[model samples]
Target: MLTGALSSRMSSSVSSSDRIFPPSSFGSFESPGIRASSCFSGPNADMNEYDETDLFSISWNQDYGCFAAGTSHGFHIYNCEPFKEIFRRELKNGGFKFVEMLFRCNILALVGAAANSSYPPNKVLIWDDHQSRSIAEFTFRSEVHGVKLRRDGIVIVLKHKIYVYNFMDLKLLHQIETLANPRGLCCLSHHSNTFVLACPGLHKGQVRVEHFGLNVTKLINAHDSQIACFMLTMDGLLLATASVKGTLIRIFNTMDGSRLQEVRRGVNRAEINSIALSPNVQWLAASSDKGTVHIFSLKVRVSGLDSITHPNSPQGPALFHQNSSTSIDPLVSPNTGANPNSLLSFMRGILRKYFSSEWSFAQLHLPGNTQFIVAFGSLNSVMIVGMDGSFYKCSFDPVHGGEMVQQEYVRFLR
Candidate 1:
């Protein structure tokens, strides 16, 4: 049996005055469960003040040590390492509500409601960090609810379909239609070119997995209530689903739709608004409405095999009736042989029953209820977007922490 280490760490230091500011105490921890302050003192410090209600989404840029956030008013880009705003942009229509940054490029896909309307816009703008200009604008008719950019530049989870586009050219390549209205969509490329899609149904709250252009392989009744978010491992082996009713996260196998584990959290009954997986697929972190983020470690083990021979074969010489005209009989014993693999499987099941245990949960403060989280950096640091339009950077340590730790701190300014 394989076991993972668990440890909790809180932020090191924060002033009483600064503690009131949620974003100031972000990175004061060396382990899990750390609560740090969110403070910024740099060129864009003046932009740090924002209305608590206007924040929508946040993202971190690993290459530049910066973070970008979207709000009702527009978007703000900040320096994570220095805790300062490098640039700020106010949209013309005041509806730049959602923002997602590409992992490999400085490109940002911004989505939000259109002017004078309660609903979001049909088009999305892609902005380049270097020029700070809208490089490409994509138009959709049904309203763009969510958008995710892969390394190859595929955007997923549109209003009622999935769209794959060229990252460099923003050219449409393929589309997958859905039976139910999709709340969210996740994709994992298994063999570089082929990928699996996980889509959450809005009405049924069910989850489905299918290969690109292939038939659905796995389907499960995922949540009782609406599914707020879902995530898939990079290798497309595991799936995690979270609901709005409770802090219960269920993980499933991608191959046969087997329930691998269930994680129940004792924190507030907040909707799991966002989820992110580490690059190595060892850790999973989720942000909820309770103003906290929870992290869990995933461990996988394969079983061993056994070998055995049949015991029912005639082992010794038996007296036959052919020797004499008199009555003679042949005796036989009941067969007790079993398939070696079957026996090995039964033993392995017993071993798992004795050694395997349910997964544990650890809570970490993310300053506030976050709408989104993205894993960036070559080290795969966590970046969360608070509902108040603040951005934070969190990392994990495999040794003493709960698989992942919040190693540093950075707060985004307006």
Candidate 2:
């Protein structure tokens, strides 16, 4: 590792019993609007604010093969495919508020919880699990909002600024200024051939896209309200964003700021917990506080866009405009999970976009009043991780889009 430490230390390992219970049924429900910051828990809350059984944080690895959960004790890692606990560190002196794994490797970016005196929140600790100690550390004047990791670089997110560094020598490469981002919202492309980074821009509802391969930066005004959550495809070519309004989810082309498609989650405002795109980019899954997970079919394809224009063309990005008349078909209704259309086709233009916008093709309903994040799993199934310590794997129908069948359920934490 970076510290050149090869010696290992003995640490306590906690064993967890995995219980496989019968699949449980779910139903949908809706409530009032939730503030965009509810999921982030604001800047003041700490590990002491939660009960001993409650999780301080939960996040998936870069490829979603596994996830890390931080608790009052320490942090635990779980495998997604076999649904087993890989390993855990029960540190008696400290707890982690953020434990980000680097694609199932031994290296992790850790930010300690407020109650952890040994490791403070303002410091980023690069822990090498093989050594059972921190190899490299970065201390800042202010609390860190988040951290992103890649094979070649490390990104540190602060309230108003983001710092990028090379992984080999830990050399500072670039820094960016952003709005008041308490959540430390940032995403990076996982593909090794290209480098793309997305984060909040300097203005409200704007997203800054840095395409390192193309040597270009594009700013997209994604929404009118504040951005709630967004996700970039593994290739970093497509970006899906949701606003605080939570009514519409828009997809954008990272090469040039252009809206590719717009899908409606609901007419009412809600807090979106997470969004996921299939590996093929043909399906998208989103979860909100309304206790529902919606999946939408994507019409755009990568090959189709590449045929339109060269990536370096000076004219404009070769893609279909979101509002282009040719992009819409009035004759056929949209493929969605919502009720059948009631309005006449001629009256669509007179009504709000909600009346004519595309909706999810399939849905999986869970209980409301809890936070959840979704990811596409193998064999047309979706894996959902909730803050309530619930984990589920449900399968959806690709041909007949409707309600999903719950395949397996487990409580990862006791």
Candidate 3:
């Protein structure tokens, strides 16, 4: 197994029968009394067999290669492509609220659920599966809302504060205080050379950006209402944010905190569950409470030299792109491929802005009652994981930009 190195390479889809978990690989030194549930059926087929409330949390690793599912019994790590459960650790009295993996290594950062007396919700346990015990721990006065893991450092998110610590020595590196962030909303860039942290500011609808590489801090007033959900690209060059209203999502340039693009989700209010960006930065995916996944095309491209050009320059596409050696200027052309403007769109600037807001190029529909998180899979494809243990792998039409085709589905938990 390539567990030592962090791999972000994407893979093609496989057959459904090929994804079944191998019982032979279920037994491990770290897990005791681990057993698989009975076969799963339709969506509403079997509710009494298992407790739905046992599922506490689910999160993707830094590279989106694998994801950790935390339940009241224990936690399970599953590979993303074949959708197989790699391994699990089910303690006798163990349950977890958060199980964060540091890449694909044996090390994990765990925060306990309230039901498990073996692990406490207020403490962060650094567990090394190879050693079969926790190597270190950090206990806070209150429950931990979230935990983020990287090779070099560990971040702990509390209700009103975030703490950064060194992974090697567990020494305190820095501390940040923010508004009442019950959701523990924060994002960290995975790029090794650039370390950027995005978290809520001390005020409403504001985000604080920490450039650890340059020792700088920037504050961006992103939205009118409080920020509901946001995401940072793997390279940390771009950020996407949505407010409490959930009608629009704004993309910003992290380096300059400039608004690059604004796309509309809908007029009705909904809770934004998750947001994702393609590895090539060509597409952005977002999920909400309405049970629809929106795919917005960020079709910005420069034909020739890097010079300032009007949005209607007729040469470049309508978004932003960043290179390691060259910096792309921030440009906004919200109506890249959306429908033509309405009759009243040209009357006022504000009216034009609303009518010209970009719409999703493609969409996918699932159960409206379930919450989901999405990530880009292989080229032109997406992966959706729902709170109800549903895993869907779907592909989109890059050219047509309409409904996405479902390629695979599995009830991974049952």
Ranking the candidates on TM-score from highest down gives 3, 2, 1
Model 1: per-residue Cα lDDT over 179-215, one tens digit each: 3454545555433443666775434667777655344
RMSD of 3: 11.5
**What is candidate 2's local distance difference test score?**
0.73
The digit string of per-residue lDDT tens for model 3 on 1-414 reads 312211111111111321111111122322222232222111222223355436778999987889999987667888989788887765445578999998899889888888767567876767767755455556666788999987778888999989887666555688899999999899988877777789999999999988787787888899989999999877666789999888899888777787767789988899999999887678899999999999998744323233354445556543344443132233333333443333545674756456667788999989749999999999699999999888899999998989999999988887
State, as a TM-score between 0 and 1, how close model 1 is to the true structure. Answer: 0.60
TM-score of each: 0.60, 0.79, 0.79
Which candidate has the highest TM-score of all?
3
How much is the lDDT of residue 309 in candidate 1? 30
Model 2: lowest-lDDT 10 consecutive positions = 18-27
Each prediction's RMSD to truth: 19.3, 13.7, 11.5
* Cα-lDDT of candidate 1: 0.52
Candidate 2 local lDDT, residue 408 = 86
